[model samples]
Structure formats: C-alpha cells, structure tokens
Target: MPSYAYRCRGCGDTFELSRPMAEASAPATCPQGHEDTVKLLTTFGTVSRGGSGAPVAPPAASGGGCCGGGCCG
Candidate 1:
C-alpha cells in the first residue's frame, strides 16, 4: 500500500491515507468529515552517495572526444 495525500475543499483540511493503488484515485473524506476532498500530487526524494560516503558529484561533461576539445570540424 502507498500513502496518498488529500486536501478537503469544504474545511481546508489536509491528511494522508495508506491505501491500495486501485483506491488511490478514490474519493477521500477529511478528518472533519468533509467529503469534498481532492487527492494531492506527491513527490518522492532519493538519497545517493559515493562509496566513500560522500555526496556523489554529477559526472563532468566530456571535452568532446578524439579531438580532445570542441574543435573537431
């Protein structure tokens, strides 16, 4: 089950619920008993690090290949 966030339009209440994916799009009732609620879009975050436990830096841009520079014409 995944948690879904919802906001009530009737009382401006926000809440979360853990439900099946099939019911993710289903209607939700706010804690205040308001049925006029809408599911809120959610975002996920990821954490990554190098083997040394340091934050990994993005790969540097290549200097353009065989020419060793952006001068291959």
Candidate 2:
C-alpha cells in the first residue's frame, strides 16, 4: 500500500490516504466530505542506515560528460 496526498478546493484542506498504487490517481474525498479534491504531487524518500536509526544521506551521483567532469575546454 502507498499513501497519497490530496487537497480539497472547496475548503482548502490537505489530507492523505493510504491505498493501493494502482488507484493512486483516483479521486479522493477530503475529511470534510468535499468532493472537489485534487491529488497532490508528493515526494517520498528512503534513508539507508547501518542500524543506528539515524538518517543516512542519499548516494552520490557518478559524474559524467565533459562539463560534469570539469574537462570542458
């Protein structure tokens, strides 16, 4: 299951719902029972840690191309 965020235009409320990924784009009703709701664009991230329970920084990207490698000349 995945969680989705939605905003209600009628009351300007924001809410979240947990549902299957297949229905992620389905219409949602706000807690105030407003039908004029639109799904919000949300971002999800994961932290890789070594059992320390501390948040880990995401992996670094591999440089590429001339400019990326500072070889543009």
Local distance difference test values of all predictions, in order: 0.88, 0.86
Q: How accurate is candidate 2 locally (lDDT)?
A: 0.86
RMSD after CA superposition, every candidate:
4.5, 3.8
lDDT of 1 by residue, 21-59 (tens): 988888899998989999999999776654766677899
Estimated TM-score for each candidate: 0.66, 0.64
Which of the numbered candidates is closest to the native, going by highest TM-score? 1
Tens-place lDDT per residue, model 2, 40-61, is: 8998877656678776679886
